[model samples]
Structure formats: C-alpha cells, structure tokens
Target: MPGLGVCLALAASAAAPPVFVPVERFTLAWTHSIEKVRWEEDYAVVASPTAGQPPVLQARTARVRGSGAGMEPPDDAVLRNGWYEYTPRMGSPQGLRLTRSPYTADYAWCVDGQCVPLGQWLPSDGGVTLLTPCARPPAPER
Candidate 1:
C-alpha cells in the first residue's frame, strides 16, 4: 500500500494505486436507479485464516428501505424501524468493485453515522472503483 492506513482501499482504475483507509467496518449505501429504493450492506475487514495472507472484506449485514419488484429483502429480514434488516448469506468476497456514473446515485461509504460519497475518494470517469481489504503493516519504531 502507498498510504499509512488499514482494512480497505479504493482504486480508481486497474493501473492506479489503491487508496488505503483506516476503516475496520463500513456500510455501502446506494439507491437503485430503476426502483429508487435505498439499500445498504454492512461489511467488515476479515483477516485471512492462513498466516501471512492479506485480509479480505466480508459482508456482515444488509438493510433496505422499502421494497419493490426485484428489491424485496430476504425471507428472514425483519422490519425494524422502517427498514428491513437481515444478515446477508452471501459468502465473503475478496473485494468490492463499484462502477460510478452521473446517470445513477452515487454509492456512500458510511461509518459512525457519517456517509461520504465514494466520489470523494476518487472521481468517476466511467471506470471501476475497487474497494478491498488491505494488510496494514506494523508501525515502524523510531
């Protein structure tokens, strides 16, 4: 990594270096362009089971406000506080790749109740922005 941060990184393109972040967990929030329903998926930085392997991103939970065709929450989702919340059964992925555009609502990385657009980290230019868990090295001793 080119920065002094941990857990996750977002790269503007395949040729670009990833922007390391000090986040252990964050929620990816967005609204469907067609249905206009809000969806949020919670994720965490998970360490690799094998030694010396880099960490990965894991889906922890999910929630959606309102439902429509193709936007229904899982069967186990519970309606709580106007949002259907549930634990996503999708297995852990190595990283998340998000494509951004002016035609659709931007994705937000929410942490501590603050949600910032992914564009803040990298401007969209019709390319994919990759978010992946990064292995932060131990701080060097002075």
Candidate 2:
C-alpha cells in the first residue's frame, strides 16, 4: 500500500502543469482640455479629441485593470491590481513611471511620486485633481 501511494504521488507530480504568474498591470490617465492620454505599464496612447489640437497638458495617474469579459490590455501591458496607495520604494523613483513615453507628451504622468511644480501648460482654472485609488469591482455573484 505504501508503494502504491508513492507511485500515485509521482504520477500526480508528473501530470501537474508548471505555474506561470502574470505580471501586475498598471494604468494612468491624464486629461487637459480635449487632449487625453492613457498610459499602461508597457504602452502609451495619446489622442486629441478636437481635430488639429494636440492632447491635453495636465495629467493624472491611476491603477487600472480589466472590468469585463473579453477586455484585454495591450500586448505590452500587464493585468494586475494594487494602485490605490503608494509608499516610496527606497532608492527608486518616488512613484512608478506610468507611461512608456515619459516626457514627449504633456499628458504623460506619474503617480504617488514626490510633488513637483505644476507645468505652465496645466490649466489653472480646475488645476489637477488627483484621483483616489479605487478598489477593484467585486466579481459578479453567481
């Protein structure tokens, strides 16, 4: 019986598939006037809502993940959680770089990093309103 148990354990181990952990995905969104920028860990997209106008200047960052079925992040993007709050990562940058393209566009932004002087391009009227990191939606109760 002991030998039979040993054989069963070996078979189970052989049949088990290796585990592959997915990378954590993060996203940051920034808007200035009609210009909007969405940055993910791996890629960045900038769009000018009005023709001829460039994307906005001010920016904000958030931790974003998929909310519905069939929704997928870009090929370079990951899909993980944990963007609500921040703690400095010892010698690293204050916050994670949210966009792939850092400074080329005004909307490119970072989150939870050390405070910096606001750019002249950012609108003064509303200014920048940082978003509170939000909780991931609960899975539908089946």
Candidate 3:
C-alpha cells in the first residue's frame, strides 16, 4: 500500500498546471503596415493598422502544455533574413512575424463556434506570419 501511495504522488506532480510567462516581443512589418505583438499562455494576437481599413486583429487560442524560452525554425524552414523565415507549418493566420507559444508545447487552432478539442501540433498549425490571419466566411449580419 505504501508503494501505491508513492506512485500517486509522482503522477500528480507530473501533471502540474502549465506555467505561463511572457518570453519575448517582436514587431511584424509588412508592405501595408506593421503589427504590435505579445503572446503567452493560451492566446496569441496580432494587431495591424491599415491606411483606410479597420485595424486587423487576429486572435488564436490553444490548450497550453509547457513553457520554453524561445523558438527555432523547423527543419524545412526557408531563411528570409535574420528575423524572418518561412516554414511549411504556416496556418490560416499567416503573418511576417511568427512565434511558437513558449507556453504551448502542444496546440491546435481554436475555430468554429464550438472550439475544437486539443490535438497534436500539426506542421501547418502555427500562428499567423507577419501578415493577415484567416478571414471568416461572410455571414449575413443580424
């Protein structure tokens, strides 16, 4: 019975709540404008102000797992410059500025009125680049 108690303790500690801490901030510049960015934990958002268009806002959410300090381009990424790179894992919210949430070890794009359940990280499951995010299908205004 004492051995069983030890196993339970170990499992409980292994599943500690995710530790969320802001790791870094980078600006995303584009032809039309730039975006101010900051992300951690379950959310990543990019905001851009256009000349005549409503400011673009892309918000993404995921179930956080673990935290890390930084990110490196995936094996198949194309290096554009010191701060810019391209990876096949790009998602709908493509942007020039890219980041993998340090607070999210595993993730999924949260979409649909009923959010998708957590799933494995897809190679094409990253956040927006330094550009536009996935636009919604037009729906009739109520």
lDDT of 2: 0.27
Per-residue lDDT of model 1, residues 37-62, tens digit only: 89999988766777767876789999
Tell me model 1's lDDT, rounded to 2 decimals: 0.77
Ranking by TM-score: 1, 3, 2
Candidate 3: list runs displaced more than 4 Å: 1-51, 58-63, 69-108, 113-130, 133-142
Q: Quote the positional error of residue 50 for candidate 1 in Å.
A: 1.7
Q: Please report, as a residue range, the 10-residue window in candidate 3 with the lowest summed lDDT.
A: 1-10
Could you tally the backbone clashes for each prediction?
A: 0, 3, 11
How do the predictions measure up, each by TM-score? 0.83, 0.19, 0.21
CA error at residue 142 for candidate 2, angstroms: 75
Candidate 2 clash pair list? 25-78, 25-80, 35-56
Candidate 1 stretches greater than 4 Å from native: 1-12, 137-142
The candidate that achieves the highest lDDT relative to the unseen native structure: 1
Model 2 spans > 4 angstroms off: 1-72, 82-112, 115-142
Output the number of the TM-score-best candidate: 1
Weakest lDDT window of 10 consecutive positions for candidate 2 = 1-10
